[model samples]
Target: PDFKPLPKTNQSVGIDLGITDFAILSDGRKVDNQRFTTKMEQKLKREQRKLSRRYEQAKKDNRDVRECKNYQKQRMKVARLHERVAFQREDFLNKRSTELIRHYDPICIENLNAKGMLKNHKLAKAIRDVSWSMFIEKLMYKAKWYGRNIVKIDRFYPSSQLCYVCGHRDGKKSLEIREWTCPACHTPLDRDVNASRNILAEGLRLFETTQP
Candidate 1:
């Protein structure tokens, strides 16, 4: 039996990127952090310890050469772990991007300059998890393959601080305030969700304005 064709429609979406949350959809849906890269932190530390011990033992024995079979095995083990972590991160990004492309058309996201964004010491991990640059890369290629659109708006669009329901912009909210009711509409605001909605709207407006 043949499968039905996928429907094509402009489904305006906003991807609010973060570390703990990864990406938030305009409709309040969340794609949790993959953390594949982070999952190896502990293991990597332990592996380092083992390598350290091996090196210490070699030094104590005054062996100018430590390329013994055991030493080679230990080095190979560390390399394998590094390889695994890289593969996991790639797999996570590919799967997540593909899912988003399949589900939504005209996916809108911020065009973030991640190198500058990562300079904030407080938001480093959160920024990394969002993986804005990697996500955008995957999103663009996948959208192209799927015949969908990936819309990128300015990073200063204020998606998070703007009230999507009332178009009221709050330029003063600190990053600490995760949830706040919109002063204008009294709507309970989810920082991530609200930002996503704003992103979606802004992207839609941009798309329509550019339409012939």
Candidate 2:
């Protein structure tokens, strides 16, 4: 995969990431989250239950657990289920990152504190399932591999609170509030999309200032 280059383009885009939708783009596009873990949770639980029951039955029957055919079969079933989830996640991230790299000259995204975000127990599973860190890592290397640029806005930048219309920085709002009217510009904004646009603008500004 070395030395591969893509066609040149001056277009750029910014992305806002979320658990509901994998990404929302500055260009008004939404990449719906696959929610692989959520989708297959029931199936996985069933597989896990099968594995557990097999182990218990083996123990109760005084059989060597390792040599029990049923136990081994169920364990492999559970393991394969886990493997499937992992493979699906990687596949989705790869395709998503590749699409962005191919279509946009420069890709912009917020610098998220992933570890800090994971501290919220309620959000931990969903956040880890979405795997924002892994997605960004793929984007970084893929951008370089495909001759595209990738930019990250400062973690401190208030992308969500800033009004894309008039550069107004509004007071912080709770995550529950998805849509709001920007006070300064009276702009009706979808939180994620607005953030994406602001990220794009900020990223462009950074690139412009640094250019020769």
Tens digits of per-residue lDDT for model 2 on 1-212? 57678998778999999989999999989999999999999999988988888888988999998899888988888889899999999999999988898899778899999999999999999999999999999999988888788889998999999999998999789999999998888999999999999999999988788779
Q: For model 1, how does the per-residue alpha-carbon lDDT over 30-95 read when each residue is reduced to its tens digit?
A: 988878657788898898788778877877887743565566677789999989977887888888
- How high is the lDDT of residue 22 in model 2? 92
What residue runs in model 2 are displaced by over 4 Å at the alpha carbon? none
User: Against the correct fold, how does model 1 do in TM-score?
Assistant: 0.89
TM-score of each: 0.89, 0.95
In order of listing, the candidates' clash counts read 1, 0
Q: In candidate 2, what residue range of length 10 has the lowest lDDT sum?
A: 1-10
Tell me how candidate 2 scores on lDDT. Answer: 0.91
